[model samples]
Target: MISLLLVDDHPVVRDGLRGMYSADPRFEVVGEASNGAEGIAMAVALRPDVIIMDLRMPGSDGVSAIRALAERGIPSRILVLTTYDTDSDVVAAIEAGATGYLLKDSPREELFRATEAAAQGETALAPTVAARLLGRMRRPSGGGLSQREVEVLELIARGSTNREAARRLFISEATVKTHLLHAYTKLGVNDRAAAVATAFSRGYLSHDNNDE
Candidate 1:
């Protein structure tokens, strides 16, 4: 059986996941954490094969915990299980070393398969999430921003400095700058403000939220 740790802020979600996994003969629900902080602690203590993490939480978020686990060289494969599927959310989680990304609404059988795949250190993305990644890969030359570039631009639009964006994205400040430069080139802008403005104008970013 694949050992699993369920990490979600909602007790109901956690309980439901626990019940589902508990009924499965191929899996074992080794632990459940109400938030990312406790999830990381339990992960360290239990050393489960797979960790099903939620993105947003009360204290530390899932991405932060994922980065912490990677930094500490934890062997558990992180499989994000959340209701969010925004570009920023998906890109950030994957970039932070999550082994897979699945929506909370995924079918039970799909979740089971994804958990098994994650335990084996394989990528398992929800269809919408996979389509987004694939679209980023297939973006034409100079047509649009790459996912990383978009992420950088979104952070900049939110008033994040290079250092802050780098920290949030788990990349170097220099790398963040490079992404900004690439975004500028793609958007045909000469500076940060222009890049953000143009991206918004071109619908690359939403007026309400860059991630949308």
Candidate 2:
């Protein structure tokens, strides 16, 4: 069973989460906290496999708590659970060492899956959150992105699959991936969809272009 630590400011929220976990045979709510500071203490003491964190709290916000636990070399993976899904919240939680970021309204099964993924030290992000993060990254400066990277991103933005992109570009699929990866680095994104979105948003790729 996956061991869990829930940390939220509201008693009712904690109660609801505890009940959800209690009903699942695959998980157990090992501890609960009302704020980030308490959550950090309990997480370190209990050493649960995963900690369900909240971003906004009365004291020691979730981002700070996540950073503190990471600095102290705690092994518990933190999975953020809250109502906020803004770009700032998602990015801060992730940069502070959160394993996953899921909104509170997520389906019960998704929450369970996110907790499981977090326990295993995997990165999990809500679909909308992921999109926002990818699309919201800052653009590179001084011609940081390569011409090939722009080409690949443009094709991707135009609804081309990797194979199709490769065929159109007359490059190998591996080459396409390499360009995409480079574009991701330059665009500060993690995936192809995000790269394309960022590219368009940053004017690296335009909709009225014909560069195939």
Candidate 3:
């Protein structure tokens, strides 16, 4: 049987999870905690196979606890079970060494499977969370900026019009526009001026590059 720990701030939620796993023959609900800090202490004491963690709580949020568990070299795999699936929350949990990310609305069978997978040290992600992670992976790696994006922004920052940049770079004006659009998305800006400014502030473009 897979030993499990349910860590959430809500008593009802914890009761529900404990009852669910308690009914399963393949699992054992070893313990429960109301917050991350308590969860960490129990996790150290019980050393369960899987920890189902909730991201937000009144004290010591899940991400911080996950980081702490990792820093202390805890061997149990963590599975985030939370209501929040925003990009920041998902990324932070995964980056902090969570083995799985599942939303609170996940079906019971899905949660069971995820818990099992996490026990075996496998990745289990909800569909939306998986798509978000895939999108992030496909984006440009460093600061989400590509070489072409930097070139386009550099030219625009140096007072080159789209047509002029196209002529100088031997690409079509349409291509210049495309590059600028990509840069704007990566830089989180709406226009050429804002993109250039954001890129320069982020070191994706430099004064020396503008001079060139």
Candidate 4:
């Protein structure tokens, strides 16, 4: 069974999630938290495979909580559950280390699927969230990204698979992954879109930009 930690300030919200997920034989709710701080503490103690977190809380918001988890090197993946639909919130949550973000009104089945995907380290973003993330990429960054990261980010932005990037770079996929991981950490972003955003925001993708 995949253990899950549900964090939300609302008792009814948690209860609803618990009820829906409990129906699936492959999932079990290991714990619940009323705020980000409590969520972090309980997560360390339980070590659940996934955490369903809320963006807003009384103490230590979800972004801060996610950042804390990433800094601590916690292995559990996060799936953010928030009411906000703005691109900034979606991007910010992802940059803070959330593997996925779903609105509170997400269908029950989608929520379950997202949780499962997150447990396996696969990304699952709501359609709106995906749209917003893609929209952020439309803006030009004016060559603000770094050299090595630019190479990887452009390939990633072109929808090239990581395996393809490894082959093109004449490096092992693991090495490519290492570079991408470092890029992710240093860029304060996760997943390809955020990395691309960071790269463009830093002007690394511009043709006139070159740094070796």
Indicate which candidate wins on TM-score: 3
Whole-model Cα lDDT of every candidate shown, in order = 0.89, 0.87, 0.89, 0.83
Q: List model 3 lDDT by residue over 65-131, tens digit each.
A: 9999999999999999999877789999999999999999999999999999999999999997886
Give the better candidate number (1 or 2) by TM-score. 1
Model 4: how far residue 43 lies from native, Å: 0.7
lDDT of 2 by residue, 1-212 (tens): 99899899999999999998999898899999999899989998999999999999997899999999999999999999989987679888998999999999999989888898988889989987876776555455564678788888778887899999999999999999998887777778899888877777875564557345
Candidate 4 Cα errors over 4 Å, as ranges: 143-212
Displacement of the residue 68 alpha carbon in candidate 2, Å: 0.2
Candidate 2 residue 17 C-alpha distance from true site, Å: 0.5
Give the lDDT of residue 187 in candidate 3: 74
Question: Which residue pairs in candidate 3 collide?
Answer: none
Pairwise lDDT winner, candidates 1 and 4: 1
What does the lDDT read for residue 96 in candidate 4?
A: 88
- lDDT minimum window of 10 residues, candidate 2: 135-144
Model 4: colliding residue pairs: 143-203, 143-204, 144-202, 144-203, 144-204, 145-202, 145-203, 145-204
